[model samples]
Target: MDERSALGLLAGWVDAAGDDAAVIDGLVITTDMLHARTDFPGGTTRYTAGWRSIGASLSDVAAMGGTATAAVAAYGAPAFDAEEIAAFVDGANDVCDLTGAAYVGGDLDDHDEFTVAGTVVGRVDDPVFRHGAAPGDAVYVTGTLGRTGAAIREFERGNVERGNELFRFEPRVATGRRLAGVASAMMDSSDGLARSLHQLAAASDCGFAVEWDRLPVDRAVDAVADDDAARRELSTFFGEDFELVFTGPRAAVESTRGALGAPITRIGRVTDDGVLADGDPLPDRGYSH
Candidate 1:
């Protein structure tokens, strides 16, 4: 079975196991794993790798509307270089600092390839969930999309520095917390917008009517994509943007639009059934490993 099926199996025994993070007694906890081959692109620095790896787990905490307290990583490499190890730690600490958390320390080991497993602990009085959306709620997405796609293109063109910079994204910890106050349902778009929407729909037992023109396509995407179709494909399916996609009552959404620090666009509205883009069915496609 695939990862989703495996998670489903686990959900049968563990309550709240299907969410971005598991919450117990007001503590939010999550973990994530990354590989050098699939996650960190060629020319990616050890520093960027550390940030991306640990930031992923922090994103899970953000999805739960929790304040990250601390983080740790299990790092394994074929052979550890002292300089590289230090750079990794610096990157992890920087990301945690930006998101109001601390990276205490973690384990190290020798392995065939560079790998990182990150765990984050957070706290929240009321955590949001993916299963709480309802029809008529407005669907919102923070920040622009297709940054990772743009970064990949840059990497292909030998713009390693720019590519690495793009790959290093701040986990939307603050944005998620803000939305938590207003969002009925929420999730991170690390698995691509289309797949994220599908997952949210399945969990909430609802659908979405998304307007294609409403998508907040990143400007960098225009530099890499050849045409409108290419732009839409990259922005919607490429994933790795690390932005929050959430839903809330129309009234609540409109009221809080101006106050949110990040730029969030109202791209759609929740519906009774079927994910749609401009009235057409949107394919459930996204990043999967």
Candidate 2:
């Protein structure tokens, strides 16, 4: 199946069963586990990687419109060292407390590579779904785009240390909450911006026009990628910029921006067909998992 279709399949399951809330409230999973067998600061081989995984997943869950009420997780270890496992447990609970998501339950397994997976449960009053956009609607994105991608690029080049904004993006839980009525369709851009836009456009059965010149590049990123041409180049296919993208009528667009109180950039317009920039096709994948 195509990438978009895969995501749609998952979303379909949610929609078919997600009968709890309206435009803003429903049963939603906030986070997914993230891990690093190497390059993690707490000693790559340490148990903290699992903790990072849980944090990353929780971030995903909280980014959507939910309170991150509870979580279920399973952990895999190579040797199951007592100390290492204990540390992993500590990491998990710490994140649970940190994010206000209750630690419901999880399992541990014996394995080679470290692995952690979490399922987060939360609620929304009137849920903002992945489908439904109209032609002539404006597209809005919270915060800046291309920061995570830029951070990855810089990290790869040995440019910065940990704790960079691009590498670790806090979920836009509040923005997602305020977006319900204002946004016709809403989704988190965990994938590249280009791919997420495609998902939103196809779901709404509409088209898009990206203003390549103003993609909200970060300051340090702009200094290096430095120009519209460069930002356009990086923002296209770079992945993991977990920002939020939504679409709505002109009025809804304004209200979302105003209510969210975040820098919402009008990157494009919803169209009658598919993607278009200045009436042309957008190149590259932006962020695809």
The best candidate in terms of lDDT:
1
Q: Candidate 1: which stretches are off by over 4 Å?
A: none
In order, candidate lDDTs are: 0.91, 0.63
lDDT, candidate 1, 1-289, per-residue tens? 8888898999989988989899999999999999888888788899998898889989999999999999999999999899999999999999999899999899998999899999999998889999999999999998999999899999989999999898888898987887787899999999999999999999999999999999999998999999988898889998988889999998887787777768889999999999999999999998885
TM-score of 1: 0.97
Estimated TM-score for each candidate: 0.97, 0.77
Pairs of colliding residues, candidate 1: none
Write one digit per residue (lDDT tens) for candidate 2, span 38-128: 3243223333454456555554553445556776778776776888777766666766676576767688888676667766677756666
lDDT of 2 at 264: 81
Could you tell me the lDDT of residue 69 within candidate 2?
71
